[model samples]
Target: MHPSQSQSCTAFDGHRLIASGPLREVAAATKQAIDAGAKGPVLVFDDQTSLPVEIDFRGGVDDVLSRLGLASAAADAAPRGPGRPRLGVVAREVTLLPRHWEWLAAQAGGASATLRRLVEDARRGEQDRALRAGEALDRFMQAMAGDLPHYE
Candidate 1:
């Protein structure tokens, strides 16, 4: 979901609502959840708290509930662990050539490790872009300070 549309709801154990706010606001809430021994998934919403956009825990519901000292009585309980990062609703599977697969295999020690590295690399690149953008904005503001005509 778009960052602008992202919201989050934080609950402790299972039923206690700690906070509900925008995704950006969840950073502080996440720390609070950790502090409060909340080991379950942190549910994210799109625009409404009643409907979840994403769930992040990475340890599975059983593990999360165990850590939080809660029980899942519902047989069809939502799996708590971090859900797979969805690209979008219309995801298309790409068939890699054998050589391409071989190359990726060679780079990845294993499939899991390779996937992890790819994700980390992508995340880092995004962070670097943001940093550079911020720097550029700072430089632009500094350069415009004395050059721009000001009234009032």
Candidate 2:
């Protein structure tokens, strides 16, 4: 399935949340709201990043899905070509110093694998920090809640 098809989305009719679910369902609901003459400007948001999503809401639901690459039926019927999309690996240029390149080349899995490992390590470190911060917040909330009457 296309990435967009799997991604969760939310639609807002102004400040009100009109729909939230798979992109296709959200788009359908957004279309319905628009067709019913929504009071405010309708906006769709990508749930992952909490970012506004731009979707062409032209024509019917099927057309909208096709335009947004959210039509699972069509995607399933299509033939896939070779490349990294299946592996979820996107290739992009990375500029590094000569010494950095030499060090990466000397690693057990070569440059790509070493870079990926380093990135994963960094991400893990960030996650650890976030976990600790969340734990602290939870403790603080528990302490504060304890002060209230009938606290559990």
Candidate 3:
């Protein structure tokens, strides 16, 4: 059986009992604080209890503010301007088997130039497909308009 089931407890929100057990147990300690009406979403674990005791802070506004410090300080600390772009840049070492290397080399025209060419080809293909789709839609719309009755 769960230890919480053996104790009487209630949640701060009054929705349900958070937990129950020896005061030393963290879950029990948390439940006790909630039952006692501590506000907030956090339960701080304390060392005093034999089992970890969680102290529920009914919404630790002061703690939150203290932790947050000055917002302007954070903003000042932030690295300004656009950071380095990671895309299209090789960041790590990759190992390839001879067969795999050969395959890539075959596609890439010898391994080194493969990725660049593939990316360029993909971009061109995408642009071409988009242009074709737009033209087809335009023609379809024109045909549909011809079939519709025009108001005099």
* Candidate 2 lDDT: 0.73
Flag regions of model 3 displaced more than 4 Å. Answer: 1-100, 106-112, 150-152
lDDT of 2 by residue, 11-124 (tens): 877667899998878888888888888986686766555556788778877788778876633454555554567656555757678999999999999999999999999988
Clashing pairs in 1: 58-82, 60-81
TM-score of 2: 0.50
Query: Whose TM-score is higher: candidate 1's or candidate 3's?
Result: 1
Off by over 4 Å in 1: 1-92, 142-144, 149-152
lDDT of all the models against the reference?
Answer: 0.49, 0.73, 0.42
lDDT of 3: 0.42
What ranking of all candidate models by TM-score puts the best one first? 2, 1, 3
Residues 66-119, candidate 3, lDDT per residue (tens digit)? 332322222334443443345433435456678888788778366767867767
Q: Tens digit of lDDT per residue, candidate 1, span 1-152?
A: 33332344333334445566644344345545765687554444333323343434445444433343334334334554343346332334445679877877788386568877888999889887777767655543443343456711
Lowest summed lDDT window (length 10), candidate 2 = 137-146
Off by over 4 Å in 2: 1-3, 72-152
- Candidate 1 residue-wise lDDT at 34: 60
What's the distance in Å from true for residue 120, model 2? 6.4
